[model samples]
Target chain A: MPATLRDVAERAQVSIRTVSNVMRGYTHVSDRTRTRVLAAVEELDYRPNPAARTLRTGRTGMLALIVPEIDVPYFSALARDVIAAAAELDFRVMIDQTGHDHERERELLTGDDREMLFDGVLFSPLVTQAELLEMNPSTRIPLVLLGEHDFDDRFDHVAIDNVRAAHDAVRHLLERGRTRIAAIGAQPQEQYATPQQRTAGYELALREAGIEPNPGHTRSAAHYSRADGYAAATELLRLDPRPDAILCFSDLLAMGAMRAVFDAGLTVPDDVAIVGIDDIEEGHYSRPTLTSVSLDTAFIAEHAVARIAARIEEPDLPPEQIVAPHALHVRESSGG
Target chain B: MPATLRDVAERAQVSIRTVSNVMRGYTHVSDRTRTRVLAAVEELDYRPNPAARTLRTGRTGMLALIVPEIDVPYFSALARDVIAAAAELDFRVMIDQTGHDHERERELLTGDDREMLFDGVLFSPLVTQAELLEMNPSTRIPLVLLGEHDFDDRFDHVAIDNVRAAHDAVRHLLERGRTRIAAIGAQPQEQYATPQQRTAGYELALREAGIEPNPGHTRSAAHYSRADGYAAATELLRLDPRPDAILCFSDLLAMGAMRAVFDAGLTVPDDVAIVGIDDIEEGHYSRPTLTSVSLDTAFIAEHAVARIAARIEEPDLPPEQIVAPHALHVRESSGG
Candidate 1:
């Protein structure tokens, strides 16, 4: 059997509370008492029960991150930042994949497994707005929503201004004298905010430039993967007078779109211009460096983690909505 | 305040023990009793206390994965697989990042913060052989080390045959008539096993091929990001007579190496050939595509989850080692 707190207390000839303080590294504990507990721990090999402490303190010093997929570079990079920040704060992160499954989303939100497993959750929800809002307040844990979900007043959220970010990317393309711009990526409505905002910006940019938006110029896919992007771009290129420029939702999708363009026997920037979002590391090394929207994933992660930790530490505080800015990374793909 | 189990029991017109059975979804509970208890739960929005249940059953019902970084595609993809497998088993995974920190690795073994927080741990140790040998057995509570490490007889482990996989990759390069093969992307000895073993295999292949190994042709990085691969490949290309081929430690690194080759006004397979390990998704999409070693991350994850669950459910069972086979995923980069 593993040595318990009681056993350590008995061995150290001290109260259980004293032993706990010493174990938790309390500064107030006298040197003599700390030494006695340390010696006892070495002698007995005491391992304190986390379950009991969690029950008593209502905190496990842990956080949970729910993402649609860890295999996706964007989400994976975000999670990496969150994990790094959490480690600095001495908090661990528990990961759950919803698989973009609605039932799984609900399960992650209200699952009994999380009641004591984590102190807070950072959710990147793919479910509908109504479904996310359906969580009962009593059962709801401390949560910080990530990614492009619309911010409601009920919960804390950290996101980017997708509209302006997209506008800037398109504006860059237009300024480069590429007018017949086509949007190629996942559908806007499928996701709550980010994609929709980007699409909206594309429309706004076209309208602002006195170029009427063509419904036929828009391309969408089930999700944002290289295969999906390639297929979407191939379909877009099949148009009679295919657009000279394309705006993609992500760098990964952009890579695929470029592949599709090359497959169709067209050169990038010279024959067709492309711009993408989420300036991933691959964008820089790709054949023609990808011109894309670069959001501070590190900043977003830090804000989300800090916000969740703040909410957990001080639940009475008002909910916060954090919006970090994004920048356009000009590379060869955009004729830079 | 949240509704308690006793409160639900009272509402259900049943004993607290009956409510416990219902919460546990115990099979022995009468149908009528289960229905009544469930109705009460719905009426009161009752959520079970996981901590209390964990204390009572001595099972946290949580699994943990300790990886060095989440940004690396291999680890992220591995985490995704583990999460998927654990989800199927109705378990949650707590993630801890060690950043290859030796102190944190030791802490993970001895930290009481982990006790009762997880039923078992999936540790991917980045420590050296001697450091691993020094681990106190008792501190390793239901631990399963993933990736290569000095496996103690008492601990369960899962790993691939790096030496054979690397040899296969290098041999493929050699067979393709590329004798001067440069190997890049090496981590510190205390950091990881895959790189170490792969490097060893590179030397062995040179020896086996009757080709003298050039120490200057081998390069290492502090980390496994594509940036490091790019840097190393740039240096390799600047050699008096650039190597005819490059074998990277990972596909991501190979992608960067290929980029460097292109940047040097060289063509892949035509002027220089390349090979990598961990055939990640990005490897398939790269311009020329990467020829690499592919391991079944999904299979490894499923097996790892089952092994940890078995250790938790049946503590008396002796620990076992699981070695999944790897294959060479032939693609255009290696002149295949």
Candidate 2:
């Protein structure tokens, strides 16, 4: 068994409180007493309890990551970037999965369990505004929100311009002379930020082009996954006047949509153009490659980590919004 | 500002230690005092310092995950599974990157900062066995190891039979009448358990079939990423006696190999048979699909969690070895 504080104290013929103070680097003790405690600690090979010390000092040097799910490549890759960023700052990432659950979303913000888990939390909430407002006063940790969501006056946020990026993607397709453009994304009424904003941009772009927004050209998926994207693309291809291009919410969705297009004996860009958001690594390897809006995950990760670290260090600072920019990455799939 | 223990204690007209004891669920306190403390806690909304509690009691309810890199799909997916499993048992996963650094590996075992950070550790060490053994004793927490080396008596292990699985994969290629088979993997001399074992199995199968284990038929890459696999496979294709079949170390590697084959104007399985291991989610969706040896990650997850919980609960039990079976999943690329 490992030696304890009491064992060290007993070996030094001192109180456990003195041993604790010595271990914690508290300098109030006499030099002789500190030396005695140190010698006994070395002799007994004592290890201090982190939880106990955290309860006393109010700082555990730990951070929690709350993502919708880790199984998704975008989120998983983002998580990898976030972890690497945190490591550079000598902080560790404790991952938590909300599974995109509404009740769990509330739990992430309002639960005492989260407050007790880490010094602070980095949350990507998928809750409604009303639900979010209800969780305001109960937050006990320094939190930095990711993804597109509005908070009244509560927490700091870091995100990209989804609506503008989406418009850029649609404009890219329009420039390629693809008029019958279809958008594949989340169900319109689902009320998530990225998908909703992207869909709105697609509609706005078509309106600006003097083309009527056809309900037939917009297909909603259950969620952002390969299978869901494939299903949505299949429906788009089955349209009487099939769209010539598709804008997907994510690269994974784009990959699946491309598969469905090929399954129907159609080629990318040449036959039907495709564009997606979140320039994930796999997008570069897909058959024709993928055209995407790059959010520069590295930049986002660094900013988010720095912001959270700063917030934890200076809790008195007012909440701020930091927006990371996106760039259009033209690739073979969009005939670039 | 949040309420402190001193505030609660003052409100309850009790000592700060009594308030702490009540918060920590110490039942020795009298009911009247406990009620007063509880009411004060409710009124003030006091949150105990987690760090101090950790210092007081050695339990942290946190586990460390040390991996080579998280960008790689296999490791990333495996990590997500590990995280999910840990979550089911109510433990948090704190991530650390070794970057395959031997010094980092050593530091991880003996780092002064980690003494109180975790109760146990789940390490995937990719270093030499000598280095592994040297660092084993310095680790204060109970450890569960996952690597591709031979098991030892010092720690618990979880692994699959990479050699036998590789043999099966190669034999499947041979059964399909592909005589000129190629092997693609990382440096076999690095002492990594899975890749080394797979290389050994390939050679043994070739020898048993009265075929010389030609060095020309083997291509070694630096890592197991698809990009690396593609480069190695492309080199193999340019050989004088080009291989008719190539067995890759991982599904991501197979994806790269397939890409190389397509770029070389060849079809999978029909012109050159291919197989990979780790049957990750991408395998099912990759173009032409991937034929590979499938390790039951979900089973490993369930078992690893159970074993870790058991070890944390009962550390006196002998170190256990858990072997997850591997199966040859015949898909489009393996003439299925």
Candidate 3:
């Protein structure tokens, strides 16, 4: 068993209370007692219990990484990087997923429902703008926001330029000489930054290339999942003057779209070219290698960890906005 | 701001030392002092610092789920389930990836290198039998091992029957009337339970069908990843009168095998039918839905969590071996 306070006290030939006082930095302890206790602690390899340490120092040395879903490839990759970065700073990360539950996010992020103390929180919620505003956190915890959110500079924010990423995906399709390009991943029910920004980028790219944006060309998906992508693409495939190309908001959606095209007895690029953002590894192994705008998840993870660490050290630091770089990967899916 | 002990002391008209004494259950404290402190604590909603709570009740209310790789879809999915199950039991889970480092696993699981206190460990290691035996964990921490590891019943073990799962996969392919079936993901270097049992099952199934298992037909993958799968499949394709069917140890290998077949201009099922284990979600969305033996990850998660909880309650409970059920999913990849 690991050494307890009694073990240290016994080794130091002092009372347990004296050892506790010295460990807690109490002024009542004499220098001789403190030195003896310290030596005994070292000799016994007695690490302070995190619970007592948290009480004495009010720091758990743990960080919370809250996301929409832990199983998502993008979020999982980001979590791995954050964990590595946190380890470098002598901190540990515990990840949790909101699963788009507003109450769960609110309780964990701000409310007292969560009893576990975190040094800082790196939150990536999938709530809409209205719900985001609704959850105006009133806690004094150090906080860093993750993912695409159009929040005013109130906290440290780390994300890629979703609009530009989407624009780049559509532009790649346009450059491939595809006029009728459709988008799948617009959340028309609310102002969610991810889909909203991507939709804006798609329209801007179309207008810049002298093509009028067709409202009917965009299909909204409730979730950026393969099933939703397949469902939306099935509808888009039936449109009059069907889109020759499709720009999906995520690689998962593009995978579903590829399946939809094949299901319709059409080939990718030749029949319906496709592109997506967030260059997940699945794209690399797909039958037709996927075309995607690779958002730097490692960069996002590193920056977010650094920001949270900084905030924990000095909460007065001004919130900074970090936009990770994104690049368009020309692959077989986009006829490149 | 949270209520401090000083606030409670001031409200209860007692010295901070006296308040501390009352909180720590010191025998010398007067009943009146204890009563006043308790009243003040209740009024202020003061949560005893976790450090003090830990000092008194050696519980951190946290569990660690250590896996070989957090990014693998199978592990990630399992992690999600474990986290959910942990949450339901009012315990939080922290995940860490071993990355197949024996020393790291040894240090974290056994040695004093890992300082973080977890109520128990849910370990899913990829270490070989020798390496596992070499690091005889000396720690008294409660541990529940995950995945296939044949050992004397000293630890709780939860996993699907690797041998049976692999047998079902090969049998399904045989039912499709394909002889000369190839196998991928064997680790000939060491006796790892997962691959060894899988290889045994593959051979058993083939032998039962009156076909001698070809030693050259079995390939070992250093990692059950796409690249490894692709490499193994590419070599398997080079054999004279190439195997008509291939049984991969995991879905990722099957995906890679499928890609290799496409790259060689050989169509799936027509030229090379494939099947894998671990019915990860990617299988559902892959070009030809992959045939796999679905391990009930949720069942495994719930059982592991429950077992750990039981062990935590009664450390002397006899170790229980949990075998989660598995089912063969016959999909397009197997010519279904």
lDDT of 1 at B113: 51
The lDDT of each candidate is: 0.81, 0.79, 0.82
Per-residue lDDT of model 2, residues B180-216, tens digit only: 9999985746667667788899988888888888888
Mark the regions of model 3 whose C-alpha exceeds 4 Å error after superposition. Answer: A1-48, A113-116, A128-138, B1-48, B111-116, B128-138
What TM-score does each of the candidates earn? 0.87, 0.87, 0.87
Residue-level lDDT of model 1, residues B1-336, one tens digit each, is 667888898999988767765664445678998899999988997756776576556677789888888778898899999998998898888887788677988888666556557788888877755676576453445777887734656678888888888899889989989999999876655346678788888989989999988999999977777888889999999997889999998887888889998998999988889998899888777788789999888888988999998877766578787887899988889877
Clashing pairs in 1: none
lDDT string for model 3 (B77-116, tens) is: 8988998999999888877777777677776765432434
Chain B structural similarity as TM-score, candidate 2: 0.84
Sorting all predicted structures by DockQ, with the top scorer first, yields 1, 2, 3
Among these predictions, the greatest DockQ belongs to 1
Model 3 agreement with the true structure over A1-336: per-residue lDDT tens digits: 668878998999998666655654445567998899999988997756676566545578888888877887877888888877887897877778777776897778654324345778888866654565555433336778888758778667998888888888888788788999999999866657788888999999999999999999999988788888999999999998999999998888888899999998999989999898889989999978999999898898889988988877776688799999999889899887
Docking class of 3: acceptable
> Cα lDDT for residue B19, model 1?
77
Please give the range of 10 consecutive residues that has the lowest summed lDDT in model 3 chain B.
B131-140
On a 0 to 100 scale, what is the lDDT of residue A191 in model 3? 53
Candidate 1 chain B — worst ten consecutive residues by lDDT sum?
B132-141
Q: Provide the lDDT at B28 for model 3.
A: 58
- Candidate 2 off by > 4 Å: A1-49, A149-153, B1-49, B52-57, B136-139, B147-149
